[model samples]
Target: MFIRTENFSQYVRAYPIVTFLLALNIGIFILTWIPGIGNQLLLFGIGDNFLIANGEYWRLVTPMFLHGGLTHLLFNMFSLFIFGPELEKIAGKARFITIYMLAGLFGDVATYFLQSGDYRHLGASGAIFGVFGAFGALVYYTKHVFPQLKQVILPIIVISVVMTFVGTNINVTAHIAGLITGFLIGLSYFNPKNIVSWRKKR
Candidate 1:
């Protein structure tokens, strides 16, 4: 249901990394529709215990790129489309990627520990939550820069957290882990020293 407007080009110029990430996710989703390939891709997704314990550690990274269904893919991609450019502009490409991957890895790790062995999870919700955390951290350090961000992001965060517990299939552990991981990473990236230096330059 999401549609790009004229401003989409501006967003692309401002955040090519985010655009590339979106393209990559969409491309993978298209590939997943190819009958047997979908099954192969799902195998790479995060399974709670037995898969990781058996040494398929790569699942930690791969699940972020796989979606459970079309609706899942669209929802996550829409979120990325909405949030990714702004965060990329703030964090820059390298740091943003680091936050995303680390958040996702930590999310998978948490899910591994918290869920029973039989529980399986997939989708980019964990990493998306990390993006939310990064936005919160940035707003925290640069409160004067974007006073309205706190108002906007807080409700989304609360709703997301609440939704996790509302459904049986939702992986609240991964979401929490991703949020905490991103918050910590954001603290490191947007710490007082950096904030002070930025303020001085401004």
Candidate 2:
């Protein structure tokens, strides 16, 4: 179910939400590389608890689109690329974006309240983790009907948790918060019948 066989145009047509997200992320990252304004954008867009506390609340939203470096961007976008389509297809565009934004916002809010005043973060990892969390919720709700699906997501979850700890300079709070938020949102947002209909399409 995760393997993407679609070509460029095909993939875009099939998963417009994921396509738009990918484009927006990559585009923003590119804009961040443009010398002068790049650093300025980073300073302005990064999530700084100090700035946030001072009422620069947009930090919560902008960090979802900012990344520290190429590896950071690639990793988060790769995760989104891999795990996003299924959820987008199942949740539909509106619901999918809602879960993604809420999960990301929740993570950023957690970071603002949990971390130090000086702590700063800029990346889409929280949102990507939310995608994983949504998958978990889907499996949890549909397990009896789709027991075999667990085999697909369980390993990914394990690897993600392990990587979160093993990696350096990670925003542990955001990851955990995003995961919880996504799962909770999924619990309330997903309809079993919708999932069934989505599965039938597959």
Candidate 3:
């Protein structure tokens, strides 16, 4: 892990959105280790759970910080570790973070609206998919912009999407919502005029 960190820092800004996101995720995970903290956090997840019974409407976001188990948490974090830096490089820190959190938020919203009662869900899969979708848009857009990068980047998008879909125990709805959300964000942000506007604002 330390070697990976050293390598990551050598190439990109260590304190970028990726790092912040990872920290937020791991920090929240640690907090969940506290006896009542995890249960309390679980209340806000998308499901027919205690949070739902208690009317904790804010759990949509809160649940995102909690995971069902270690395997679930690790998978999400691994995806973030793998795809995050690349996506951050393309979208930059602020936009990347915005897309990630919004995508997760959107995922939970979709979950809440689509599902029936008595089921709850949580994880950062939504945000991970968002990152993946954004990276896909980068490829789609870059083929026209940089053209040469397609050889490498296009495959990354395909494999990532496939992994998201094929993986077990994934919340497909959240992934789909996140993917669509990310694609839209990428398209809007990369639009010629919007890019100019975005650049100017930044």
CA RMSD of all predictions: 3.5, 0.9, 4.7
Error of 3 at 169 (Å): 3.0
What do the candidate models score in CA lDDT, each in turn? 0.79, 0.90, 0.71
Candidate 2, residue 190: lDDT: 80
lDDT of 1: 0.79
TM-scores of the candidates are 0.87, 0.97, 0.77
Q: Where is model 3 more than 4 Å wrong at Cα?
A: 1-13, 44-55, 144-168, 191-202
> lDDT score of model 2?
0.90
- For residues 80-186, could you state the per-residue lDDT of candidate 2 as single tens digits? 89889989998889888888998899999999999999999988888888888888999998888887779898888889888888999999989989888888888
Q: Which candidate comes out best when scored by lDDT?
A: 2
Off by over 4 Å in 2: none
